[model samples]
Target: MALLINHCPVRWHAIYHSHWTALQYDQQSITYQQLDQLLSALQRQLLTQINLTTPPSMVRLACIASNGIELLLMQLLCVRVGWLFCPLNPRFTATELSQRLAVLNTPYCWIENEQDADSLPTSSPQLQIDFELLLSNLHEQASSSIAVTTNISTSAITLTPLLIEPEQACNIIFTSGSSGFPKAIVHNYRNHFFSALGSQRLIPLASQDHNLLSLPLFHIGGYATVLRTVIAGACIHLTTYPLTVALLQQHRITHLSLVSTQLIRLLADPLFNAKQSAIKHVLLGGSAFSEEHLTALAARGFHYHLSYGSTEMASQIATSDNSSQLQVLPYREIKTHRGEIYITGETRFIGYFRDNAIHKIAAEEWVASGDLGTLKQHKLSIIGRKDRQFISGGENIQPEEIERVCLQYGRVKQAYICPTKDQQYGQRIALFVLFSDSTQFDLDCQQLKHYLGQKLISFKQPDHYLAWPLKLANNQALKVPKQVFLDSLSKQGLT
Candidate 1:
């Protein structure tokens, strides 16, 4: 591992020597020098394509793509130029894309290619930049660019001063929006810098470690991985989707991040024997984790970290090594008021993007994270989302509590409990269970009722039970929208 400064005014990538590997994709590997040249070329091509109405600080360089080298380079280019790099979910529908683009106000967007054009509106402007040609042209000029960069002293070279300032807006990532329209969360260079720094302290990464780009680039976890890898001078592997055990073994990945669902699927993989793998640390986030899965990982001698974070806080606010409670990482502060978590820190986002500009969040203001929790002895334990709590039969019900109990059931793989209208009780609990075995579809409701009868009190028990809607879960989004299940139940006159 090389000695590298974590935070500075200049581009973080420039901190590492030219020979260090920055990115890896199957047979190809790119060094810091090569990536720098690619980023410069991307910046030149992007400027010629965009038509901005605001200053560079306000300009949003919108892109729709999956986790890949191009998207990673685009974000680095945005940081270099002070543009707000907004990455939209490529799986978004035409309508979903249009709604978000209306808020973005950028004249044009960069799409993957012609095939992706249909997802955008007919009137929406788009630029299909030829990355292959851009890379080829760079190869022709690689010698000169490499020589020019290497000849200059590190202190003499710097990204645009005003544009790359720590306070300048750097990225706009949308919330998962599991039930409704997503909010555009804004983050500055400082937010990401400290986030990467804090994360490295908890989950140490070195130049020799290979960090898997497991999550989508549109996600905060994914984007944070890019910065963490660069700041630590580590290598990032851009692996293929439906990530298999074979792929993990082939890459010899040391560090990775995953949602609970992805972790469960990987554990279920026949080829996965956690004890034999090279994986050193796994950062688990997104949803409530299953104890059964954790126990399985423990039985297999796998190492994992449970983290709690949001889009508003860059990525990780707190993470746990082996304990149930999360330990607050460096550069972030957390407190509980009336059982709801409030956070104010360097990693706290700039604000929510709206009306073509960020509605800035003052540095002194402590943002209320809608999550309810308890802070004791400097450790945080999450209860559940305040918004997810509902009143049924005049008794308050926290869906996560019931969902956790359902997950404990051996046959249940994923459990989601949502509230639906009930004439007798105003609102009633509805359980959607994704079973581990397909044969569970024939499960008798009475048997589940008996099981719940033992685990839950009468009031917390679910009124209706249904098998998980497979079609609704078959999306690119990390978590399935809970509203989708409620709607399906509504169609069946169960609401």
Candidate 2:
């Protein structure tokens, strides 16, 4: 399929005519024509005030802004100009942003807040403009100028759209870095295209669908949703900040991508059952969903597609359809190499940004995912992380298996198993849990121990239990970084 982008200005104008609409925070809507004019003016302002070349270069364009129509337009402009777009999460601290920008060697940085621009490091060359100022300036320019003619090509700008190949580095996405500092994973346009196309094959979304933009655009889940929508010629309903069940009902969202924790919270809400009929598919990933939670959702007549994906692979490797059975996509080829999950095919990323020395793909062009799993009957079942397995009493203990078992209990919402230092066993398992309804019902620790003892071998059972509030890290919406939880345990004098 051809890329759903128009190169010629007149062709783009004709193609996008009456095809776009902006859903603002206040529920106000703007047509595609208005959005185009706004983007044209913004593009002109960016060229004039931001010291950007008339047609931009292949240099990186960084932006830190809240979720809005302007941010979306900026991204589109970057794509049109063939510039690498790096969107920083608005939640990042100044220190974190500075450190990342330094490592990325970003020449341009756009900030929505003027104070943030003033606070930027002197060594970095940045032209920060507030969103309000940009919009106001564009509005003022529109009043004075009769025509806003954009020179798509300029001598100063050497970069052309076709010059940047599909394999060329496009975005640098940082991992959650719960273990250490975040690593910038380089992904190309081909990686994203294949990922979106592969996912579309599994879910079968069309132009009639309205995907809810619940996840943060900075993350792959949120970013992929946007790309999928555009590629499918569908509409996206954007929420202001935090995605809640109420917003889902208000927008009457048909499709949504959510983490396991978010799904659990939505299931707990009273309105979920009443409004769930409108939702056709909820793509669940980021972490493993408990069997009990799955059962609960099933009971509510809610449909879900359990997906397994990572940032390094763009988004998803395997995703289930409405049938509730996991289906691997055509572009993705999955196999088990020495009990470790290795994947290859079209959707894999080019490489990481920092470490060019490290080889990302195996001999067969398959990426050694570090995750351990088995393929049975052509279906993949992830066992756990091979590196996360601990030797206990001369036997290997996989935390994921124990956690999966704990999830069978209806009281347990989410569970994680970690190994703590043990003098005799070398390492013993520790269980961290988040209960679904902790106020009225709770999982008995003794009962869980006995239950696991009957199901799993003695070495696999957790030696201790800790109940805490679970929050997914900001970087990637996948796994809860075990290292982060371990640090928290140390801080509380529990480790």
Candidate 3:
């Protein structure tokens, strides 16, 4: 018999046995039984509060919360009921949330706190379910005399069996919307399950292991990790605070997933040494990583797994194990058409949600990833964005390629490649760099120009250099708006 989404076969094992530790938060450990019970209670409340007699034809639940047991439980409840779960980033402003919410036409929304509820537009009729109140209610019911009664009409609330077909939409994750408003990408159970399973095959996971949950539950990277751990019956350590070197040590975290910027910070910390035996695997992606960064990780004895993935792909397209340098996994395949990477395999997403503007693939399909790469020696190396490429004096240059090289410098914290007008070159390449400390780092424009000249061809070198401080989004620190940097440079008359 095929596995279904509503009734995950794993749940049977989870219900009977309590050995699996589902979550650790605030120094309190929650077992699988506790998690299961919590989910059941939440589901009951949802049914009663929403008057859900039957699951919607197109199930969609909008969840807005940070990383915690509550967020995990909400997702699990949705999966158990075959509901389409949409996890929205808590950091998004009300206007941003409204735009995304409008696309889904979600009937119910779960939010972190009352502040989020207040921020929501009054005109929007969508019900805002307070997470704290819901939790309090669940706790009260669990502790009350009503807990002894098993007479609640479970029959009215039908527990839909999980019959996940290959094509059914499981969830819709929106992009970061840095360039424009975020697009909702629809992924099925197969897409998420395959990503987790494929990753496990490459980097072996055991029931004894524990994974640190620092990534936002809204993003695919963070969301996929939760699914992977639950399927593996492993423990997830949830941290409300930011991921720092001290936190990793405090938790004795074995596995972690980080973006390039996070890894750079970890590497800079004096206490960060790969020789420490506790950490097992550090998966890095989300942006281009410098060759120097890879080499440094290797030198420190830290096991690094480089991945190429996006919201549309569900998480990882191609992953390499650090044990053998950086080689693509055996089961994965990669090919480039017109410099764009096209991935076809079990781990691909079903399609984008609601919007039919984008073309769809036929049955047994593949995704045309907008990002570019080249496959060499059974390994894939990312070049740059095909759309971001600009022309300079009849010569074409990829800014990401140049930025990758610039990031190799130890003092440079982050870099962006933008195009500026030049009378001689037509359109000259410009570099915006963020340094660790301006006082200590004395490298000037001339020195940077010479450095690039030695490493790159004359046409590829950035003609303009601007030193700027890094500023992150108010909600999510990981995302930096490229337009903001460009505007700043233009204001200073540097562009």
Candidate 4:
């Protein structure tokens, strides 16, 4: 029988997998036994600070760090004390971070290093905490605890458990908000519990598995990995390193997750040998999978699970295990109402946070997912997001439809179609193509337009073609900044 994830999986792991490897970073590994002691010390530090200022329940914490040991430790410690943990992307500029933190409403952020401290928004209201200082204290505690723990190998260390109810907010995950402004998704431990249990149905995990931290902790994909690892009592391989074939082989990773773009980078690498690797499963999400990429995955014999999800739904709403057909996870109920997806489940987030208040998304039968998908054979196939669909020349045009056609070709590596103003058509499709063999292939406008004409309808064809920017060459992340594309088009007098 599979482990039905409870609200307190961390505690369950502590009791059962005490001597098992719980976490690993660059030359650092922590067992569940050591983790219990570290959690105890951190708990005291957390309570010490809270008791000096306010009640533990009232104090919330956020983390601003790149992927590392400190960030992971704090994530566990925050939950142990029932303090909500908000993870911020290190790539965000001070301006971007400020805008997000303003919406998140000052939750005492923990900076990973002095460099991050310097990058803080000048003249912001958010309180900053020193992660290095806390690490120093933890080291001191570890020194004393190791000797005491060496003798008592077969026992459990008593931990101060948090009073975390099912509905209590435990995390705040900010979305990419590709449609609009990023949303601060408020989530409880119950949400993570359900999300983990549901995803396990598609990608079954075991206690002996080692899952790599492939995605950033700030994103829901990365956050979900952490949840799944803890619930399964599996070990997590942490790294500041990028996701590479060498890294996977070196660590002997049993499972990992990736975005389509990230996965493409690994597949494109000539050194990557799929047959020789120890990895058993790859959970792919973030964006749509192209036909070419899918073919490559199949050829390499990679066991991959495709998923469709959002931050508001914790992680995945629907998933497929190494197949084209997608089915909803065990915990969530999904339905299509007028071409848009609606979901209702235990995995649903509490709400969005802004202006020192909670803007809750009511679960009245279902929550509108802003995505359009069709169900055939009792399986879901996504067309696109409802918000991404736009009209062109009196016909409903989905950019993804055009993009899908473009990606079906042999040479094209990336496809992005945006709406540009057109007086005659009301709005026209602006296509941007990035070729795989840039040196051998000709990217002339007339040549590519003629190529697209053969595969697409007249109305569905892009009115304008964008010159691939040289700056984005060989970049792993396929997304080109919108403004960059628009600005380049204007300079060429195309818009």
Most accurate candidate by lDDT: 1
Q: How many clashes in each candidate? A: 0, 0, 4, 0
Better of 1 and 3 by lDDT: 1
- For model 3 the local lDDT of residue 110 reads 73
Q: Which ten residues in a row have the lowest lDDT in candidate 3?
A: 148-157
Which stretches of candidate 3 lie above 4 Å from their native place?
1-10, 51-57, 125-167, 274-277, 323-333, 355-361, 440-444, 473-479
Stretches of candidate 2 off by over 4 Å are: 1-17, 20-26, 49-57, 114-122, 133-168, 178-180, 274-277, 322-324, 355-364, 376-378, 439-443, 469-478, 491-495
In model 3, what lDDT does residue 391 have? 92
Give lDDT: candidate 4, residue 431.
83
Candidate 3: count the clashes.
4
Task: State how far residue 46 of model 4 sits from its true place (Å).
Answer: 2.9
lDDT of 2 by residue, 111-139 (tens): 76657766667465665444576456445
- Using TM-score as the measure, name the better of candidate 2 and candidate 4: 4
Tell me which of candidates 3 and 4 scores higher on lDDT: 4
TM-score of candidate 4 against the unseen true structure? 0.89
RMSD in angstroms between candidate 1 and the native structure over all alpha carbons: 3.5
Question: Which pairs of residues collide in candidate 3?
Answer: 4-162, 5-162, 6-162, 7-162
